[model samples]
Target: MKIVRPFSFVLAIALFTPAIRAQDGVKKDDKANTAISYYKDVRPILQQHCQGCHQPAKAQGGYVMTDYPNLFKKTEKEVIGVVAGKPADSELVKQITAHDGKKPAMPRGKDPLTDRDVTIIKQWIEQGAKDDTPASAKLPTVDANHPPVYTQSPVINAIAYSRDGTLLAVAGYHEVLLHKADGTALVARLIGMSERIQSLAFSLDGQWLAVTGGNPGRFGEVQIWNVEKRTLKMSIPITFDTVYGASWSPDSKLIAFGCADNSLRAISAETGKQVLFQGGHGDWVLDTVFSVKGTHLVSVSRDRSMKLTEIATERLEDNITSITPGALKGGLQAVDRHPTKDELLIGGADGTPKLYQMFRTKDRKIGDDFNNIRNYGTMPGRIFAVKFNADGSRVVAGTSYDGKGEVRVYETTTGKLVSTAKGVNGPIYAVAHHPKESVVASAGFEGIVHLNDAVTGALVRDFVPVPVKGAKK
Candidate 1:
């Protein structure tokens, strides 16, 4: 076998071996060169960690990362956030990466980005940082001028009357409809980017409106609107899901709200900066209210507990509800503080409304709901909304059962059934009492705002809050 090899065969073997080795090297290079997309791989990282502070309304440090072009712009300190093809020279990379065993600087007060996320962002910048966002992924412009067009009325989840009793804010799709309290005319439309508005509140001074909502699985937002100017003052994006139960402090200096992440948070009204964070709830916090003095925050949760937290120290002070198992049959959904006292009116899955004193008047004992003041008669279904009248004389609760809805008014001290609003057609999610008049506005799945006489329970008038396309007014 060794004696009969041809010269051409030997030459061919040598050439083919080197060629195959070179081809293998090329395949490895191709795998390393795989593109990293800004939209698919990098944008989500920013949305989760950075956009909460760097969005348009809360552009901390003058860096806005919500849009692609804003990434390459100069910062307030004249530093470039991202430099194409040079991750080491990029300010964004420097801020997110650690040096001398210290944590990253950006995403201040939060945990640093995961190693994998950091690598993806660096890789995207190294690949020239191209924007690969598709047309469908782009957010539509929604604001005061370019308002949301509703083909049909959206399910109203919240409504509130201004402190002056002149304006009614109704939750709508991507907006809050401001109507005259009489329900005769639409006054203004406060449009924003959130798809669902969960809760609404007017500042005690009647100068500002606070709203909580978000895109269902994407983000949570807190919007502060200037009531008189009809302008969006600030938009603060927070958790991953919609937030609920926004309430303003008595001084209007801070706003507190419940989050889907089982946490309660408060922010500065002027700066949109998070000032207080409490994580005592075992389930999603459904509603929140400040104590009369604004020193304590009372939050009701789906965990069947109402926990109080001290705002100054950010510590859980007490569990106002009994913690004994089976004491609270279901989760709590709505909460409202008394107009003049420290009493709380709460309702939820149990369909019963119970008032609890905000502070403990006695020592705690096992299995004792010591703060329970009085129990109002139960409604026909799960209560989604509750409120006390101007003078704290009466309370209103809205409920939904099967396909029908009911709104009930009750005397606060005597616990007597005052009246039940008539002509409600669908599930009721929101109810609000007028500040100076004996009227209550109720709305829900049917999308019609009903003005009912608080004393008589008769429907005074009803109207769809949003303008329906091609439909007569």
Candidate 2:
């Protein structure tokens, strides 16, 4: 006869065997029934592909997918976008599903969604289309009426004067504040969803303002605002980080900007469609400027090089800077095209304001920085901003170091120092010259907008762009 095991041992084996089987069964069920999250899965797909055209500011075809509730609402065609527990019957599923080998009808002009993304969206709807967006992820409604309240002055990354010299646009938290040229009164607050305003530019005709920025890690956006109507005309979401150096084309038909992803991009100012894309930079592209005629784009990058790209062909025409190692002392941070010429005013980590011809006139040589026109006297710190006057006769550069900032004006041709602005403290990240007047606007680590006389460099006036909770307006 077989030896009998102890009673305790037998009991333990029996208990452990069923427990292992039960655990395995639970894990398998969990793996099969995993819930698809609207916030985590579906939202990102929409944000990357659909939100640009379907947000509140731009409800394409009278349908919006920016919010979960909007997905279930009926579209302009009276078709429900999503129907809970029935993916096959949902209009959204129908629109996204290929038919007769034809591409999906939605996301017009863009590539069809990947099979995986479409499957995820369908699965989410099939699982009852529940709202699982966390409260912490919800952003407060911010607009002109419900503007962002500031406890302290936000870091000013950019400032611009309207083409007509009537209004000044200063970058603030989630908004661009329009002030009178004299800085005595606030005109209007143009607000958007981007938290960081990296650059601001007004169209040549002064009808629109182009803004570039975004949540640092989430997304980048190019915002076109109708200045006269004070309304957001277009919001084009781009790469997965903040964008910089927004500049409008001469005809105001296109807006170009630099990206943290080392690419340069341009989009139609009207429809927000990407019309141009150039990805030649080796590092983060920090600034960009369009050639005077708008035929080409010049982008400066943290790779310590300036590159020229042909807009028509999306071809990288040349590296404007020298290809020799260590030609640039450091990465470039700012660039501005001359008002009427194919010349550029640039500044960056080296603290020198440089003027460079946009196009190469001679054959390329590896060691030659042939396009470099002139180099102004080095400032005390890194130059974060450089701008040409309305006539391109004078250039202003702003810098910051050792917790102090300085603004210097130089004669563009002779490289003669015009004046150094007085009474500037903190790191200066932005500077703008009035289109018609002698006023120069500067702001940075300190949130106050300082208007100085461009000729004499005397402080004209300074004011906080935002309303401080306890301070006078």
Candidate 3:
């Protein structure tokens, strides 16, 4: 020791100090790690990010993580779940951590996992991924008879009216609940599809109801059901796992829908054949509406632009943006055309509903208008659904960014705020106006469909299709 060099002394301290810290770090991580069990640490992460595609009911790629047993089972692709104590060897870890431009990542449409989240997952697996779930954490096996029960408000993704306007089809978990338009009785439940019903539309003739949705990241499908027969007519499988805006043609011969793959496609109602594919959206296309004349189709997208395409020619009619395009920000989420004019009512993340003249004369066009006629403000959330109230004089918009569900009715021509429905209690995803009356129906996160007088905004009827005896929804 008396002859030891300065370098030797420093090296000894470096090695010894790290060893002490390593021991301390392990102690700390383990203390935190003790709380990391399959039910506690891992399940919440999967439920938020992975369950949409991996749950038992959907089981995309035959990987079901709805329970502890399902979570640890090897995937259908023959991928190992967790090699004991070896996150580096586990296929689940590799897939989630993988970054390849040639292939899409896990949780296809949403954000990827964080580094800390990855560490927690690895630690859980390293600790044997024990099943420590409490009794209350267990969920019922989801099936036709045991469909997903809403403990909280269920988001209404789509809604439609029968051609005759006698029945309303409200989107439900693995089913479409058909209710009397007046909300007086339950007509029937059209059950099919895996989950996530995005859009529903009764065929123009009202003979068929076309539904668009799928287990995101696993499969995207369009299911057509015969209204009277209440049977599946066609199940058109799409290449992507998510689709939006199933729009029926004016003649109801073909159905056009937008896909996650940034393409607009059409399928023949009779043959189930893909007839047209137009790729132009720079991002996800959110909604599509057939022009009243059926000569063109208008689509809005996350790209912050609304486009018009001529159907027969499949050519671009115009690429329209908001009035304050450079300043205003948010994806356009909904679009509905005037019943008789070429004007469009659009809503988006910006929390305002705007009326735009799709085809304006030179005299009618404003200074650098970009088709925007006027925008209605004062709404507190992003507009998710908008429609011309059968007559085209009034425009209705449903909004969602905030927790409070809001529906606004405005004078289509004057952009005057006519009526507003408050106390929706959650986001309003789908809204429809009675074809022959002043009544309007709205449903969303609350699960209850609320019928209101379009003029007075008075709640006339509110009913839950699948009522939870003691639950809020």
Candidate 4:
């Protein structure tokens, strides 16, 4: 039987159809409005592409993206790196999006961000750029009670012996391990900082030890410790991830170091005041040394330049490599000045350690020009550490490449190879000579601190500072 539908039934069908369409629209809106989290969605992009150049320590172009607070704050140049809820108005967004030929995209020489990454960053800013990172997602918290656990091998970066030749200090994971000069006993563990220790120097009086280092890409600091009391005397946090090649003034009144930010800085030993600052290098400042008279400071950098700064006036006295023209062809990594003369030694990626005369003029008015003496080609790897013997008769260097390390000594007057030691099994970052003996100490990727007889090139002492954690003593 054919029956016609009721008017109320037909009207109800139409009403429910519109209601279902409205509910579907609500679901679509909810998916579009899913909140974008900074830690979850944005941080990975930044850490992968941005943190290398834009972080708290090396905030390139005055922008830092490592932390939420620094990212949202305006820089000293009055340009805000990121603006909450306004991605288009932010400097970071502009730089990232300026991939056109008119303006350079950031990461400078690296590849630009992917389209997906850019969209996520924009959405994060649109969502107010909140700091949704959990406490555990932050950098490893460091404190006195809970020392930072260095999971990797203690890749030693520096080693020094007291002026009296009694105590030897070797760089540790987060402290300085002071051992007897003979390496038979442990004297003290100098603990104060929470990062890798890169360089260490004992004052002329041997009463204080100056340490330079920090967490790479996080912070940089100089810590002075009283050797007698084993107490921290002073702490100076720098404007980079870490520092290298710390040198002491002749009078032991100040300490100078080359920072990762390409700046040279010095601080007073008596007071923590910054006594000198000379921003001269275009790349990472790898090494620095004070003149024998303490009147001038010399520094070498990965920029392939060496600079001299007057201590009194804090002025760039000269750029040595500029005059010599191609004297240094690669990144200069290590520098050492003569103890009592106006000569210096430098080594780097060129795989050759060369000597230079600081001043050659009779009246000494003409300065800052390199007078290259000789190139010692005894080592074929990157020289990470260089030093002159106490009498300035010989120079020793530590080098490493392709997982191999070596220590070489050469006569200063001639480039004759005097002695060589090999089979370190890893890269060696530091080497030091005894003030009164022919002893040499080298340490690096290998955990063992290797001491050698500089004259014979024989391994004398192999001091293992950190044994395998779970292994038996």
Candidate 5:
């Protein structure tokens, strides 16, 4: 079955075959391009045919085909340019074959960007492009400085890279029993939590692991374990209710959580002290997060509001009365902050993930129109989980579309949907990006983790040993 993309978009695979390419990472002289190295000759081809609009500053119709990363980063629409290395499986080539200049052609206007130009883009991206930036004038590209994140596991749910991205804390049931990013090997299993773990986070100093959303005896639960001691430290009861979210502050001085309680509460990280708790929402509190500065925290609730609180003073700073366009009757499902920028991105039970100004103060009411200032827009599904990529330039969201789900990648500044991994049979329960590599681990209704190529959305690994629900030991 052929999925069609425009002339520039082709889901090409970029793989190096051992049969032809040398096993030592170098390809044999006769080996073909992996869609990446095909760049040197293809840049001019794109510049001449498609660069009039799809250049750096302006990508037409939200699509840019100038470079490999930007091309993949800008648009992952079905049948688009270079789907990795699969040439015969590319959509661009197919579109070129369609010469009617009908609704389905490239460059879409006066002159069709010729068939040869389309072929070169398909071949170059698959072969990989060369770095053309002048070291003196151009800033370093993310790829040149930071590599892809967690490459193993394929599907990542809750990932907290040790302060340095050198170590990772990943949670899953089956064999995600535990592995390190470096591969030195250590038992990932630490006992006492429920067999069904949901989210994972590490303390600021990397001394503890806070695992939330699993069984809490019958009081439901939230427990903190000391990593070095390997013993349970303190247990915070979730008021005999279901748990929704959990997080630790940047200073390691506080631990905050949200829930059926309708409001978010902060407690002392060391004493498990009730730092402060408020109740106002008539419904559940779905997600909560602490800003990187440690000065504030934000929460999304079933009350149809996004609330930001100043932790130190225990005061409400800004309240996003309703996250949806019309205050839609749904809850906010997930929330996350940027790595360095003063911005907070939120996802809702309805299908839009809105951004927020992290610097907004309590006295200045952001009001309902806050979305206008923060770049609010629609999402492909009910955003369930959200996390920033290593640099915070992009965001990863787990979404639900028509009861089925996938993870979507978007630019933080423009609120544009750049990539999506769809067609999963059920709602995606969670989505998380790797701290260091282009690896993503997502798990939903079926329980098995679906690891996908974070950049291309291709299936990289299936962590399901057995039909998660259909088979039993």
Candidate 6:
């Protein structure tokens, strides 16, 4: 059994009450998708943080969450604990985060947990409710001598993990490489178009890679690769006058790019066909992404606006919400997803990066409301990229602040500061987390990949082998 926080007991007690769950998080403007996970991932985090007062013996506030079968025993509806895979449908998470200011997420006011823990809980609930099985919550950790192996890339920009967590995709310095997560053996290096690879993204099925960036002497192109055969699938010719971004559609059939042409273009992943080509931004399209709900698309442009379009028609939703000029516009640098939520994040154009909460509603409406139950934000450095940890509760933001090109973590809902990691002198260009652990491998302008301790915010290895107390070596 793990040590439980005290205040969380009070929260559980309050949360068990049928009435309290009903009044939990969700504002009129909140536009977040509901993802419910029950057993494997969800129950463990909840039991560890919330079971103190919610057990059958205590039955805090008349609520007993001892087991899934019994959770709805006395509850008015399945909405009491969670609806599995939908945060909006589950009142448990909302109550902990205190969506309506009724209660501040579990363990109350102080964040006794990290962002990773939050996301894992959310994902578990969203994935159809797994049991609090030891296997789901526990993992085989890497010992000092037995730690996983890997190779680093030059100017690495992005990374992706296979759904099974067996392989990882790395992009940087003109190539996209696939490697076994445990061995780091090079699987494939995307041939052709060798430039300082600026951005890389993997298709939903982990079948393809999308590469985008500009070089001083060469043109920029978005290349899609076949991971199994290690072959280039399609390349969208492009050039970023300054900066650019690349992403694959939810279905992984279309590739999109934010290019120097001030255009957002989507190309067929298979035939390399042009699916959609729309251009109208006053300046460059800084970043873009498909809404998780799969109903719309979004982009932030240097011209000072965040645009939302219905995905089915590639047309702006008739009443799309307006979030004029993100915090970083002309200097807009990067954008990242909420690992498990229907939210997207934006980075800055200058030295200081501010995180914004962008959420989409069930009806296809989007908004930037910090008070939203499903929407959350963070304050990071001159951010270039922000990606959700496997769970989506915690997000790592890549920074560009000189000497401060660090990766920072923050709680998604309360905006609570988590940790800051440092190692590079150049701008922090990209960051990605291991699918299961708190380890973060980052690449920067200085051309070095760093393996970092996500929880302690420490560099995984010592600079000169000086032994720190309790050092893993």
RMSD of each: 12.9, 11.1, 12.8, 17.4, 24.6, 23.6
What C-alpha lDDT do the candidate models reach, one value each?
Answer: 0.88, 0.86, 0.75, 0.77, 0.57, 0.57
lDDT tens digits by residue: candidate 6, 1-473: 12222345347545653234334764423312333335433554555455434543234555656456645444444346666567666666665554564546565433555554565555556556655444654433222222222333255566666655666666644445566654236555454343456666778887776777645322455666676776555444453232367777777877777765566667677765566665555456767777676555667666555566665666654222244335223456666666555566666555333444454444433453432243234333466776777887776777766455767777666666577775645667777777887777666665555667777677773121111235453
Best lDDT among the predictions, by candidate number: 1
Off by over 4 Å in 6: 1-154, 180-185, 214-218, 239-243, 317-330, 350-381, 422-425, 461-473
Q: For model 2, how does the per-residue alpha-carbon lDDT over 1-473 read when each residue is reduced to its tens digit?
A: 12122344346434443223445556744532667778767887788788777766567877888677789988889989899999998998898888999999877777888876787788888889898988998877665557898889999999999988889999999999999989889989887878899999999989999999998867899989999988888888887678999988888898989887678899998788888888788777888888988899999988788999999999999998887987879889999989999999899999999999999999998889999999999999999999999999999999999999999999999999999988788899999999888878899998988999999999999888888777775
Count of clashing pairs, candidate 5: 49
- lDDT per residue for candidate 3 within 1-473, as digits (tens), equals 02223345347444443223446556754544444666545765675566545654356777866566766668888887767677887777877785555332676544677765676788777877677877885645664456556655466888877879899999887678888888888877776554778999888788999998876754577888899988777666674356898888888988988877677788889877777777777677778888777778888888788888888888876776643447447788888878778788888888889888876455423335657788876588788898888879998888886577798888877888888874466888898888889877888887878888888888898888765547663
Off by over 4 Å in 1: 1-34, 45-122, 125-140
Task: Give the alpha carbon lDDT tens digit for every residue of 174-248 in model 1.
Answer: 889999999999999887767899999999989999999998866788999999998778787887678999999
Worst 10 residues of 1 by lDDT: 1-10
Winning candidate number (TM-score): 2
Q: How well does candidate 5 match the true structure in TM-score terms?
A: 0.58
Scored against the true structure, residue 138 in model 5 reaches a CA lDDT of 41
Q: What lDDT is obtained when candidate 1 is compared to the true structure?
A: 0.88
Q: List residue ranges in candidate 5 displaced over 4 A.
A: 1-177, 181-186, 193-198, 214-218, 227-231, 321-325, 361-367, 371-377, 422-425, 465-473
Better of 2 and 4 by TM-score: 2
On a 0 to 1 TM-score scale, where does candidate 6 land against the true structure? 0.57
lDDT of 5: 0.57
lDDT of 1 at 167: 91
